[model samples]
Target: MRLGGRRKSTNIQDMRGSGSRNRGGFGRPTRRVRLPSGGRTMRSSGGGIGGIVLLVILFFVLRSCGIDPLQILAGGGAGSGFEQMLPQSQRQNPTPRATPRTDAQTEFVSRVLAETEDVWNGIFQANGRQYPEPVLVLFSSQVRSACGFASAASGPFYCPGDKKLYIDLNFFDELEQRFNAGGDFAQAYVIAHEVGHHIQNVIGVLPRFNQMRQRMSQAESNAMSIRVELQADCFAGIWGYYTEQKGLLSRGDLEEALNAATQIGDDTIQRRTQGYVVPESFNHGTSAQRREWFARGFESGKLEACDTFNNDV
Candidate 1:
């Protein structure tokens, strides 16, 4: 990522270091369960019918609250993914909190966001649609979102309700240290992935999924979610396609991103957390699937090529 002279995006809102109590509790960071960090650090693999039943169960669980499970699951696993990525502790009572960030890292995130704005804006303009720039909320510990309260524990996510992407910069540290997926491009992939969710929301994919989930069986909904998440991965690759054409990617950047997609696959996360793999319970695709979809979008650079829903995985 040769972002030497790139400009920082002005859309970021810094809410670090501020804390307030809510009816549920005080603002606190999500409690991250410190999982051990030894693994292949390279690649891995994950399946089928019972998955649909699991999806239905999750939908009812989340719908009990105010969340539309399908919309939230549009990017990954049902509630569990949210729980693992963003802890329940922080969401209990979100308050404003900020931490000191290295100037270099913040600047790097801003540059990536700026590039996304330019690239997506261009794509939308070419299609005769206006691009709505999403604000990147940079917070530490905890922050509130339209989807609900969040903590860095949830990792980076886009809240469809609010149309904003929330990122805890510290997650990047974890990405580098634990996943061995370090690099500017890895970070960009995170941003682009979330922005990809925003794209889903803007195009009504998310809302439609929410509606369809109401009439679906658990397995059917989860299957739908797999497509949704894979599509977002493809969208991120599409963004990467444009960025690469703009000469921003350096030699190892794509490798870093590919490593990242594999590292965060549902199978890899499950194995890391529970010491076993459950294909039926899998939500996010396997590492190979993620890498393949992203590569498909990046190489083809055509929106029509990103039809993960139509392809049999």
Candidate 2:
């Protein structure tokens, strides 16, 4: 993406590399709390009711991300069916302490997130809704969150309980070198996806899902989750749509996001990690599914068109 002249968002909290050392042998402090089955919900509180709306939109998106909700309910991470593959110890807890980053990466991520804010805020206002900017927490190793502690190994995520997006800048290197999803737009996609979750939270989709999860069976729950995730992917595309319309996207930028989305699809990640595919357990959808949903939003650029739950997406 060509964000050269775009204004950076000030709604960022740079905590990269600044993790607590004395707490664990790994020298990483968990940024979030691990309360097991009943962890606190992340909330968007830095702003007012208008901002809260934006935060809620993202929160609901995080809940399912198109994962099998039943699998998650059976011991999977509510919003992280894929991430749960990693051991609990590997996740970071955001208890700010020691940081190993050189500070440059922190600025880079902050700037990118800031740019997302600019684009999203503009979009919300154009649609007659107030855009509540979410905070981006940059950390290294581990960090604590309102939801619980998370490790860098757990990857980047948006905590609905706190309405803050957590990211380890180093993950960018991993996305490129390890996952083959490189480029600035790939990085931007990750942020956009999380912001997409923020959008869901603001619109009350998350709370409803959480309630539904309580009443649904495992298979049914998973299906619901898939719907949620696919929608987030669509939402990301919506952001891309606006970015392109605003002339912020350069050639190949959208491709970078598509590459990222494809690379991280449930099918791809499952194949690489488990050596097989379990369609029922598939969360985040297949590479094709992800690409399609994102494209839908990017092309349509209409929120009404992003209703993955009701549509054939």
Candidate 3:
């Protein structure tokens, strides 16, 4: 990705090297050096389904908590997608411990965020609606938000309650080393996938899903989640569509994002870890499904193409 001279997003809340104890019991970063979540990295993928356009947005909503999502893809096994809504109180507003010094990687993430803002803001404005930008929280070992406590091991996740995406930059290192899915675009995909969840929240998809999921059985929720995550994947692709048009993408950028998506698919992770696949446990969809939805959004650049609920996925 050619992010040179791009504007960095001021919406970021830098909290690296900051740690605080929480009732969740996950305060210390050293004690819980997450496996590698860059690549649960609860990313999403796929096409089809109908109804709420925003319904396509929640597919990338919550990831499994503190489960090095990438390590699972690298062969840890028994994993879920990147939409984790930790059962923390949304009222908590813990103060920042400190703001660690920024670096090149931080600047990169901020620039990518700026790109998404430019894209989504224009999209929403075109439709006569204002796009509410979500705050991307840059935390280290642990941080607190309306969504509760998290560790870098939790990977990158969007909290609908708080409308903020949380990430530990170290997850990128894991993406490159553990999973071998490296590149700036791959990182952008992770951020965009989480932002997709925020899109769901803004458009009312996430609120509905969060309410409905409570009444659903575990299996039913998992099934519904596949659609949700895939839609988010499509949303990320939609963002990619605009990003590409802006001439920021290099030749291998799309593949880098797709490779990251494939590495985190439920089947790919399961096949590598357990030496078998359990279709029932699948929540994020297959590798092909993810790649397809992302491509669907990228190739078509239309929200209608991401309806994973009404059409065949």
Badly placed stretches (over 4 Å) of model 1 are 19-101
Name the 10 consecutive residues with the lowest summed lDDT in model 3: 66-75
User: How many clashing pairs in candidate 1?
Assistant: 14
Candidate 2 lDDT by residue in tens digits, 179-253: 788898888788788887777766776656766577666666767677777777877887787677667788899
Q: Rank the candidates by lDDT, best first.
A: 3, 1, 2
Alpha-carbon RMSD, each predicted model: 12.2, 9.7, 11.5
Off by over 4 Å in 2: 17-102
Q: Which RMSD does model 2 reach against the true structure?
A: 9.7
Q: Candidate 3 — which residues are off by over 4 angstroms? A: 19-102
Positional deviation of residue 34's Cα in model 1 after best superposition, in angstroms: 44
2 against 3, candidate with superior lDDT: 3
What TM-score does candidate 1 get on C-alpha atoms? 0.76
Q: What is the C-alpha lDDT profile of model 3 across 1-313, one tens digit per residue?
A: 9989886676777666533332122222221222222321111222222323444343334332211111111011111253222112211223333224236777788889978877777566445466777777778767676666665565677776667777777777766765567988988998988787777677666665665565556676677677777878988999998788767899999999999888878787666566788888777788899899988888876777777775677
Residue range 1-313, candidate 1, lDDT tens digits: 8999876666666555564322111123232332222331211100111222233344445444433235254233122132243224433223332433445676788789878777666666545466677777777777777767765666677777767787777777777776677888988998888887777677666665676577766665656667777878888898898788777899999999899889877778667667778776565677888888889878876666666654566
RMSD to the native, candidate 3?
A: 11.5
Candidate 2 backbone clash number: 62
